[model samples]
Target: MKNRHTPCTECRKQRRKCIQISPDQPCLRCQKLDKICARPENCALDPNNEVECLNQEVNELNQAIQRMEHELKTLGIKSPLYIKNNTMTLPRSTIENLFYNWKIKINNGYFTIDTGIKYISDLLPHYTSIEYLSPMTSYSSSSSEDSWSDGGSILIRFKSQEYGGFYGLTGKMLTKWIKKRMLGQQALLINHIPCGSRMLLDRLVDIYFNCHNLYCGWLHESSFRKRYSQLKEPLDDLICASLCCYVCATPCDHLDFNAYQRRDMCDYFYLKAKEKLVDQFDEPDKRLENICLDLRSEYEAAKVQTGIDYALFARHFSVAYCLRITLDCVVNKPITRQPIPFPVMNTLPDELEETKDFIRVMTWVNHLYEEPFVDMLVEQIHLILIGSTCTISFETVARMDQFLLDFGKNIPSEWRLCDNVFDEAKCRKALDQTTNPVAIHAFLHFAVLIVILYVTILQPVSVNDENDLLLQHIQRNALEKSLKMSRLLLYGVQRLFKLKTLSPCHVKLTSMIIMLYLVDPIVLQCSSPIKSSVLEAQKMFQKCLDIICNIRGIQREDTPPQLLAEKKDIKDFIHNGSVDIDYYDRFPDPWCALLHDVSQFFI
Candidate 1:
């Protein structure tokens, strides 16, 4: 009896019958062609045995579906938008009713604000307050859910405070001030929302972020809810949206392309970001040198206004930080099979092949900065100032860039690399806690983190009274000193996380990790059981070690086995100050506090 499963091609081409190996590989037929050949992809099973195979396949698929359903049920997570499982439990009539009301307010000045949105709910309770309603405390809970809070309790409403020697204006006073600023203009009044409303709406149109637009219309009093998709992809800013357009013509004059229309605006920014490093590309000196000049000019302007030499110090100020951030990403991901020891080198003392990856990332960042990165900074300044109601323009970026180039060129070689080492312990401690957000957050939020500080943290402080001028001056100095102390901490973080990789050309890499709300103070707090923050401090130190070991070139095998076995001792050689508190004792408590704060964030 001959094997019936043998392929005819195998027998004819190979001059032998097929064995039909479990993971069928190339038979002699493919060998002659010098190409990969395998069992036919769509070959059917024996027709006589077809039902058996079909039944088995059906069972396997059923088992998989069951497992997934069980997992979802156990996890208490609804498949909000999955095609098979997603369903809108809400009535269509309810949604249509809301859209009716929102339609009238689409272009209204009041709808664009924080106060006039109340009518949305009263018109159709389901869409506004009933469908997606959640409480303040609820935001702090929930997983795999989209929840964000930009302000504390005072953000949505007005609160009154008694003036008995203890006070600034109450929430009521602030509201009045903002209202007066608007002066007869309309504002939105939206606060409460419906429960599970986000889930229902997301199911209808398919979105989870709860960020896009919602339309409203007028319908029967019995049914006032309706929903419609806004016709544009969500974008973080108008500038980014304009940049992403592929249409050769200007935005208003041309039709928008729908090619990547399904992608969220946030994803689109990164997609475009990976393309130009910004919205523009640089050709060596043409792009980069022009950027540096622009930045230096901005720095000079800032310096003249405040005597803080924003231009002279900004580049040096940014160097270590930028390196840590860009390098960390590349170094940790290896190119070779070697056992990579971590506690990545905080500084590149010598150039090595392993360090190549990190250098490449650095080159990209450098190019990026010299490219549209300068534009981003300029745009960022405009955003902060405009949103906060101040005045600024691209002129500042140009000044800062020019000033920095001169300052950096004039800097002594040793100073350029932090060779002077004033209080090396301080820098190391700062370096040690670069990865921990909790420590950094608490430090930044310490003492003056009240309402006033939120508004004043980076603003100029002015006092009108002559009698209290001296006291006010002292407070102002303290704030400025604190800011400088924070910057020193930031530099430590940037330099330490630099990475290395193998690339055709040598690359220099450096970076600093800036996290969003989810993985940060929140995760930092969640990692430990203790609430006193002492546990947080320990975690900070622990995280620093993890990142150090992540450096591309540094590994246990490269160093002496004995030293590698005792990691702490080796780390001391690089940064011994981190483990010792006594050396830091001589420094002012504020400085120590800042270091402590910086360290606490990573662990």
Candidate 2:
């Protein structure tokens, strides 16, 4: 209402350089910001009021600076960086190396920083080359052959089964690596199985790498700070490749492999499966030699195509394979006993098979560990528990209840929310649940370590039985193994509970077990169970009978038909403790809960 006053709408709400809307219809700043212009009362803001407020702010800021200066003067201290020498003097870094341990943070598993970085970098141009790329340059090269080479044995020999070294000089690394190497030689074996069995290895790799597409949105640290989408074409492709790589894992033997039971490998069929999988790859990426070339920046137009999602592939493959493996181990060696010793590398002092029983519990817990399901189920639970506005169906609740039965014993999870939720206790419980996806991963890994320890520590003593020292050493090694893993388990549990996303319930479970283990290793060992074995002879015998019975001649050179009945005898001999369904029914609720828990937490 004051004379010569600008309208509040134009001045503050519109943020325009306004004299008065009555004087001029258009506001200047509105045009600059490309916003719509309107009458003064269009907004609740008053321009004169805003000006006064701003002036007060300016005064406050000045006073704050003055106060800060006076405090600094009294203390005889200026800014924290107030050195007499204005010139910069970079001090020698105490840290030997400053490298980001940038790992691909997948829910169920993690990749080594070095492995992930190297693998992803392979898809992108060299750091130096990326710096030189101009928008004018093209990125026409989109061939695996142009990417990396058919490093003939590198994939199998280095990355595949003998995969223990995938993380660190981990105990599992040396052993698994060797195992895979041996398996890759299916051609030479007396009985050949699939070399890359189930093609899970590659699929896991593909899936993780493919997830890089999501990375394009991530802000970079540099000047442009561009999202992944803003990057040139090839870079995008490389990112896609990284995401896909995570998906591609080596598939394991199928559970239904009973129908296609393998017999003695005659060095012929062994070559077939290996060749078939390889031919599928057709043109192998033989860029191994020229992988160092930085030509992408110089040629090809900047056009890109989305790559694969190898992580998804690998995840699926892993789920199937791991399930198959779990079944194999359990089927081959069932734990009929009540209490099991936690598994030790060599042999425990007294009854270490008890340890293996604990591992059996871990296996049970694992069946529930499906990555995709966890996130979705967690979401529903969150909505039901926390969001009064949302209503979840009884059917959904039942399913979720079943999920809880399987894997929720120790995990504290959120009811509902989006983005960046970390429950350390739940994560710890997830890690400890034995049925966790990574536990199986670490299982295969620990197997390698056992193999190494056997080879390095136990094997030598067993082999060079010099003065009864071997058994003693083996016992000592076994004790150390149990203690070491127990410690890792304890640490993993503690760290897991601290996560923000975990619930108090999971923390309690983790703490309960942690308390037991911390209180007494002997008690934990007594309660723990043994790990199941991985090879089943029942299917083997059944298939062997089928093949022999199918023979035309009464006595063929390949396999004697007379031995068909003998095969059942062998099967009966191996599966001595096989019991009735009532045996499973007899299990109490807690055990039932454990089973359900595993089904949910593990895939």
Candidate 3:
């Protein structure tokens, strides 16, 4: 009697001899009868081969268990009990113990179970494997007739639920913990200020109102002056620091005397302000709100004369100040330092209100004032702010580009070129004669907006191989043209800063330009001409940085880590004739993060 492979299921049920040409195909009899056919259980090439296949499968399973145990040992974790359950009993107690250990180790920082949970959940079979398991006498006492497959059914169900629950719970709890920690570690609001004179205080406050307050107008001149007079001997450092920031932002002609005196006074006040803002006030937000209220009252009184809407001005200014205060509080703080609870986070809804007010005021400015420069400046600021903060779609980008292009046509030729260096005397003379005293101010504002637009818009455009080469060439040419225009705009900014004609806003703007010079995709491309242009732009930027650092007493080396990192890359390129352009390519938009970081330096 000869042994043979098992017959197909249909053939076996019928107790008929099955004839087949291939192992995987239907038997000849079943195919002829047009019946569905499947291979019989325990079927193989031969009796010995079936056992050999089972041994190989068991060996592979053991090897996998050993590998998992080795990995567990490497991570300093004890091997799980399931690895040793070769009999497939998978005890319910062992499964529970494994989960409990995982929970403990997860909290102990031994492992991050969230990723593991996701991995396990993804690897699990969609349907339960209980039906496939061999029947066992251990669970035979259960009431259900199909419930005698050991603990595999219970273990599978528990694993599915446990992993999903743990992933969700851990994520929520971790986020809650982080937010709570941030609230506890709020940055100090104010520090002590060195003693100063009433005259110097008055001068600083005047500068603050004239330069910083012109755009922000968060502080009213009359109310600020009255407060200055009412306060006894030494003024509060918060007020004093705010005053210093004002003077630091003021141009030379805005000062009564010489540039040297102006710079010296600005520096003195800046340090005092930083010390007070960083060290003194425990509840900076409350103090800042009080200050803004006083200014708001003043803004209401002079709203008719200033031709600026109080609600719009106050909201925008307050947001800027809030950001400024937050940045100052964390400036010298470490990145891994306890999170500082942002007071402004609660007031974020006010930003929407501010946006609405801006649109309303902008309509008034355009319709009533009919001032193109003012309209353009407001529009540019609106677009830049929106673009920087939001997730813009392709349609929004296209619309914004069209809007800017239309506005660009109206930009004064002098604004496009760096033909005239910003001269305080010349600026004052021009303002004194012209009907629009705010022309230079508007131009400076426009310059800052252009730099922002460059960072947020132009630099990010790419040319793909699938695109028409001619179209690509056209885009590259346009990019080169825009890069030149950006450099020229930056040149105007540097001149303004050099002459002390711009505000602290220019410091933020120049810092952004420096960032762009470092990582702008066009500049960072592996091309000589573009790289040389970037280096030239850096020299101009260094001048701007020097002037800002001189007033703020911040050294170039003391700049933010992101900027410093870019500087090193540039240095490496200059020395070794190579730079890691790919490092910058990793960023979605490298300048976006840089802009965000630099914006903190301002309001």
| TM-scores for all predictions | 0.18, 0.21, 0.37
CA displacement after TM-score superposition, residue 266 of candidate 3 (Å):
7.0
Best by TM-score: 3
Query: 400-422 in candidate 1: lDDT tens per residue?
Result: 33443343343333223222223
Q: How many collisions between residues are there in candidate 3?
A: 12
Between prediction 2 and prediction 3, the one with superior TM-score is 3
Model 3 Cα displacement at 383 (Å)? Answer: 17
lDDT of 3 by residue, 1-603 (tens): 235568888778766778888877888877866888887576746746656766676666668769977775544323233333234455576556444644322221123334233322232332123311313223235455233222333211101111111112222333443454321111212223222667666666665655445543355455556666777754454765666655554443344533434434444556556656544322457667757755653443432423233444534544554344223322311112111221111122323333333233333222312333323333322222222111222333334445545454454443322223223344334434433213333444444344433333332322354434433443354345445545544444444444443455534534443433333322222222355554654454444344444433333443345744663323333323333334432333332322233323221
Of 1 and 3, which scores higher on lDDT? 3
- The clash numbers for all candidates, in the given order, read 95, 125, 12
Which sections of candidate 3 miss by over 4 Å?
Answer: 1-194, 206-218, 245-400, 407-437, 455-478, 487-603
lDDT over C-alpha atoms for residue 571 of model 3: 38
